[model samples]
Target: MPSFHHGAVEIAYLDEGEGEPIILIHGFASSKNVNWVYPGWMAELTKNGRRAIALDLRGHGDSGKLYDPAEYGIGTMAGDITALMDHLNIRRADMMGYSLGARITGWLAYRQPERLRSAIFGGLGIGLIKGGGPGENVATALDAPSLDDVTDPVGRTFRAFADQTRSDRKPLAACLRGSRELMTEQQAAAIRVPALIAVGSKDEIAGSADQLGKVIPGSQVLHIPNRDHMRAVGDKVYKTGVLEFLLRRP
Candidate 1:
């Protein structure tokens, strides 16, 4: 549970295993532990001889919290990832991210491709380019005083997740308000790193992984059957795809 500074924000992270580096970024309302460690990402990557480095994005986990809408976005969080890499003395490493993490990875792929060997995007799909980002629904849900007030299925789920994780509601609300930016089709096409788009076939939140892959050069899609957005995070198939992709690329 070590932490570092990215400007005024203190980003907490966990570094485990030993080998070539792989940086892991958690999704919205998730920390390194919930997103990667508790799900066994560290063990799998490390056992396969890769370093697993995970971070608590600024507004989540034990990292610094900011309620300002201006404080969070694609570039802001993506900058946090690279800053963490630089702090660890890692110029480049494989990058894996889920949900919002995947979006930040998208920005990384476009803004700092040299800082990544390959990018693994889980729980992201056709929505990566076409449309739909974290909109006001989820944000408003986080601010709702009680679950009884949230009616949208997706918003209710996110609010429940925030409650379950004991995440700060205010920061999360602000994060949702400010940080739903998605990469354009042209931006996705601009990624220079080898990429893998893995999505659950049943995921309502992310859409089609195969469709997203069609736009990114040298990208592949790994579809996990019967899993939805939350279920897909710790799926064995998703892990296997990531490990194999790393092996092939490494």
Candidate 2:
């Protein structure tokens, strides 16, 4: 793993394969390895002649961690991505993100369209505009002394995931607290780059993919059958649809 400084934060990342680049951003409580590499996404993209890049967002994985909620704003997190691109001398690249990563990608797609050849919002949909995903309860869960102390189902699930990942819960808690901002309908409509909205058909967390697709002009939607939020990440259907979208996008 190589790393570079983005302001005061050290962002750790993996760069693999060749050809045009596509950067992968993982969801909450997950790193590049757990979200992309262990799931074979890196192999799939690299084998298809694409440059696969994935980073550990600040406060997660091997990257620098911050306890201040103010430091983890969605826009600030998105800036980290842009800084990573600049460091690599990449002006633009295809971008894909899941869950929290999807929200960060949405922020970039809306505010920094010139830096993205295309955008993929995985595990996110109309919630991009509706403004609801993990909330304060999830943050509380991270703050809990143990998973047993987390009574909220969503919070408990995230706490268990954090435990499983061996993540430091304090920074994650601040991240959850600060990164919950949402894009408006106008912002979603303003995205002009090639875009794909991929969500699990059974994903309650992502809202409706079709609805989100309706908002983003010319965007394509792919629904992974019978998959929920977590299960959808590594689905073959998702990989196939994403590859097809990347192949055909302008």
What are the per-residue Cα lDDT tens digits for candidate 2 across 1-250? 6999999999999999999999999999899999999999999999999999999999999999999999999999999999999999999999999999999998999999999999999999999999666889999999988888889998898899899989999999999888889899999999999999999999988999999999999999999999998889999999999999999998
| Per-residue lDDT of model 1, residues 70-161, tens digit only | 89977888889988998999999999989889988888889888888999889989887765645788898998999899998888999899
The list of candidate 1 runs beyond 4 A from truth reads none
RMSD of each predicted structure: 1.0, 0.7
The CA lDDT of each predicted structure is 0.88, 0.94
TM-score of each: 0.97, 0.99
Off by over 4 Å in 2: none
